[model samples]
Target: MKKRNQYSAEFKAKVVLEVLREEATVNEIASKYGIHPVMVNRWKQEFVDRASEVFKKGPSEAEKALEKEQQHVAELERKVGQLTYEVDWLKKKSDEILNRKRP
Candidate 1:
């Protein structure tokens, strides 16, 4: 099976912008870019949809919330790792003390 081609955001934007320019047909653009017309159309639609956010005053509420959630998850992961190390160290120390007492 052949893997699908992946274009970078910048390249997608460039192609989408060309389509929006009305100078060339979508088929022409797709053929030039070596991509499918359907893919080109999809990129153009995404470009149009996201274009509004570019003019918005600030980050959207959802974006801010998502960033906050990611940070919180990272902090929790750090704490979990620290606690796991501490628990492992305590178990080892306790086993050492128990062995000493047996002798």
Candidate 2:
């Protein structure tokens, strides 16, 4: 069995752009890239179909993920601060107890 070739997103976009440019036939672009002409056409169609997504307004998935991570970090920082205060209070109590016992 022959292994299937996988093309990167960048390469597919480049081929699709060439197709859209009308500078060459789909077959010519495919031949240049050693890919199937059908794949090139599909990419071009998909690109056209989703082109509006480029202008859709809102925070992207990456932005949402970053916000979630920042919230988590803030919660962790608060917990650390609480724990440090508790540790300091315990140490002070322990030191006072030792000092009283020494006298």
On residues 7-98, what C-alpha lDDT tens digit does candidate 1 reach at each position?
89899989988999989999999999899999999888888888888889987979999999999999999999999999999999999999
Q: Candidate 1's error at 97, in angstroms?
A: 7.5
**What stretches of model 2 exceed 4 Å from their correct place?**
61-103
lDDT string for model 2 (1-103, tens) is: 9999888899889899889999999999999999888888899999999898788899877889999999999999999999999999999999999999995
lDDT for 11 (candidate 2): 88
RMSD of each: 3.1, 4.0
Indicate the TM-score of model 1: 0.68
Per-candidate local distance difference test: 0.93, 0.92
Model 2 alpha-carbon miss at residue 70, Å? 9.3
**TM-score for each model:** 0.68, 0.59
